[model samples]
Target chain A: MSTAKDTAGEDMPWDEVTPEAARKLLVAAVEAFAEQGYHATTTRDIAGRAGMSPAALYIHYKTKEELLHRISRIGHEKALEVLSGAAGIEGTPSERLAEAVSSFVRWHAGRHNTARVVQYELDALSDEHRTEIVELRRRSDAVVREILREGVESGEFDVPDVPGTTLAVLSLCIDVARWFNTQGRRTPDEVGALYADLVLRMVTAQK
Target chain B: MSTAKDTAGEDMPWDEVTPEAARKLLVAAVEAFAEQGYHATTTRDIAGRAGMSPAALYIHYKTKEELLHRISRIGHEKALEVLSGAAGIEGTPSERLAEAVSSFVRWHAGRHNTARVVQYELDALSDEHRTEIVELRRRSDAVVREILREGVESGEFDVPDVPGTTLAVLSLCIDVARWFNTQGRRTPDEVGALYADLVLRMVTAQK
Candidate 1:
């Protein structure tokens, strides 16, 4: 309900904002939202965390929900960036799928707060924003599903239920945020590699 | 800080506090916590949902945190109940693991609200209660890790990292609550079976 336009500065670009300011604000927003529930977090908290005035934040975004929308959108786009980069690689189904899974796990482990806010806090978004985020999430899921389907059709995997299998794979990656931390015995790379192996085996054709 | 006093008609044993009543209150607590969050849900909200007066609710439990504690404890205990029952039964590693995974997924699906509240709302608990719940969660994680470790030791599986692999397996099960619904494409049973198979394949030893 807190609109951002109530607080924009004269320095804001007409058509787009600067990447550095947006990134700084997004990082601060992610931390605040992760620490406080989306509904409980105020635009002031994000602005304070970013060391900027509320007016400066408003200058960059029109609404608090708009900031959340941007955060969710960026998270989804980053995931797509990882998956899209892996899509064209030349490899067997298992290899390509493992790479995709590895990328996802690493991305999640490194940017856990962002991932958590995006995945768990979307329910707090406006209906339109929620729909947009959900669609982005669907596309992300589809990337994994398409890989699994390709593996099945190519005789590299033998999953009986394509959609469920897709869910299983993504769930394994998305849940890293719930438990992964620097204090854990395994590094992000270690966990990512192990998950990649686990997922590959899950879908690969049984010997 | 709502507390429930044991006042089961003077002569009843503590353990005899009727599962129906306890379950009713537990379900109500789960719903209230899920909808309004742990910090926001009051004993009265749960009591209202369970069609009971606050005094009657207090007769069964001590503290709102205790209610959360009980819900989490019971949920983990239920998981251990299934695991302990299935333990030592004669089967291949994949078969046994599949049964375990199925039980976990099915339990979470059936207790989705409890699962969500326990997993997502721990931040609202006091430190002592939170520590207690964390221990319970760790014990549950230990059960799955033991299974994976035994599989690896017996050459039934070949995981390089036991802890991460165990976390990955549990992650797959835990994330089900976030997405599973009665209106979902697959019934809980179907999802359970698919996930069980997928998990089994993930950890089964290569031929």
Candidate 2:
């Protein structure tokens, strides 16, 4: 197996560095964290999973905590990125809401392991780190809430409690990771489309 | 500093044990498992929290896995028990469903720690143990699905997808343990009532 030191010779410059290396590292970290949880996962495990030595792993990230923090941040950021893009598309409130839900389900399905780490491992971080990740989570939640709030305000949805509805929608999407797996019957796209329909029905006003 | 032997000297029979003792042990196990995860928690840790030693702990349960299994089995049984009881009451499908949701929320709120362990720790079990627990979970889920299916058949609920709606409802309720702490602003009763209302609205046909 190539050691982390072996990869050091091929390290690209900052601007030229592809996310391929970091992405592979993050993917391995997510599987380790999800399987063994945050506190149990060692840097060596992540390094081994990524097919690199511990020293080579350190070339990409400083500590096990740092690796967790980076994966969580990236997962949150990617989710926000997708939601923000969804929010920009022009459509009726119901239509836009459906699109946003679809985006969330798709993102979650594609990155279920990373999503699990982001959702469950926040407590393993230090106070400052936990706060930072919580804020990121809040922002992602707020994006979904904003879309639902807009739907409710526009009379397209009739939620009795805005906060509860927001939580319901987000929870439905988030919990998909707990059960969704390749071993299951439905493909990610199928689940995503079905979820989008269900969510839309959940929030939309009865005709 | 008392051992489990000292603790079980009291005349609390297994069948007639006080809810207080069971609750105490369950709470201690929850905190230990939550902090250390299931694999890392020793019987001593749970006994330590319950102010007893391992021998006393074993009086109520044969093994650590048995304790964990009972905690989960009891939680699921209580929820199913509530649902079964609620189903016998005379009401519209919507009303009964709301009552079922209320019962679920109350059960989870009252036993949040046990709920957390039951929801999150199955993966740590041996394959045979995990399968048994999974079956229990599926049976519990089926009770909810039966209620929803009855509603659909009676034309009292307007959910688009029966299985998907069942999942959404269960997901919303189960995720409460992830964030519902006693320190939060809302009381458990208040949260339960609010969630019950949300579920009713989500599934009920408009007047």
Candidate 3:
């Protein structure tokens, strides 16, 4: 239920996707795909939502799939950026992991629409497109895995299965998009903090 | 990727949704909705998949939404049964919570196809139908919340926000349907065990 603008202010994700019309189409596509799902949406619906004709839609993206691909590519890149930024920060692995989860969860909750389409609509993409997106996702996973691995190495955390735990962390954050609502009781920040605390508990070593 | 038969054994969730023909249509509808989503799947497709005529579908259910509602209702009841069974077991709060998460997660992963349709297609239901389904979900939430409340009251758990943690635990388990693949490295049992361990860590008091 977040207005597109709610997620568009400073550090906006889609600012780099061009031209302006193409970005509009991409934004509209995200909205449509999130609301009705990828299989039920059409290129004409994206074009209409963007205040353009169907023909004009083709001028920027030839097919609805292309639009989805672009949106997915950009969205994944943003997600990777959020995780990589936290992973690279100068802090203990626990601190880094908390930051990574909190920020990643915030993005999913704040941009629930775009995150929903990016996280749930992978099957709608062509094989080639899906492969590219999956690669981006792998990098995101690696960032979290590295944090968990470092924590275990440093004896700062007690994760028994780093890979499985990494998947759970990412899966936990990604699903915030499915249930988050702008009108919900918890704000994005609140949920982010709560999840971060819970995640930290999952990894913290018992004294 | 699981076959319908894989989840239709002795403890099949839909056995109670008779008659035989109606159950077939419901199973077929779950497949169609899981594969193509609710908006994109037609009743004709459900009928064909069930080896029945369109008229047969009409005789059993007036509309596609009716099929979805029945599936949702039955699926939710099964989910509630899983959680409530775990909650009612004679064990410590920690043991019960672990049992609840493991079994609930197992159901979501082992029956991913039906779980996908039941969890994700709620938005497509009619308002009245959605409200009914939502009420069922509230009961599911209540079951989990009661367990967490007991854990907190018994001083066996370190939960700061019982209601919020309940949502996180339920959200984590429900999402297994979205990412769980039959061909994936982890089996339903393994994933359930891993998740149960992780969730236990999330609530156990630090020594």
lDDT of each: 0.74, 0.72, 0.87
Off by over 4 Å in 3: A1-13, B1-13
Clashes of each: 8, 5, 0
Compared with the true structure, what per-residue lDDT tens digits does model 1 show for residues B31-96? 777665676577888999989999988888878888888776666666677665554467766667
Each model's DockQ? 0.52, 0.37, 0.79
Which consecutive 10 residues in model 2 chain B have the weakest lDDT in total? Answer: B5-14
lDDT tens readout by residue for model 3, A1-207: 123373333123477777888878887888788778888888888889989999999999888889889889989998899889977899999889989999999989888888888888898899999999999999999999998988999999999999999999999999998888887899889998999999999998887
Residue B14 error, candidate 1, Å: 15
The DockQ value obtained for model 2 is 0.37
**Model 1 lDDT at residue B157:** 86
lDDT of 3 at A50: 89
Q: Highest lDDT, which number?
A: 3
Shares of reference contacts reproduced by the candidates, in order, are: 0.63, 0.30, 0.70
- Which digits, one per residue and each the tens of the lDDT, describe model 3 over residues B99-167? 999999999987888888888888999999999989999998998888888888888898998888989
When 2 and 3 are scored with TM-score, the better candidate is: 3
Span of 10 residues, lowest total lDDT, candidate 1 chain B? B5-14
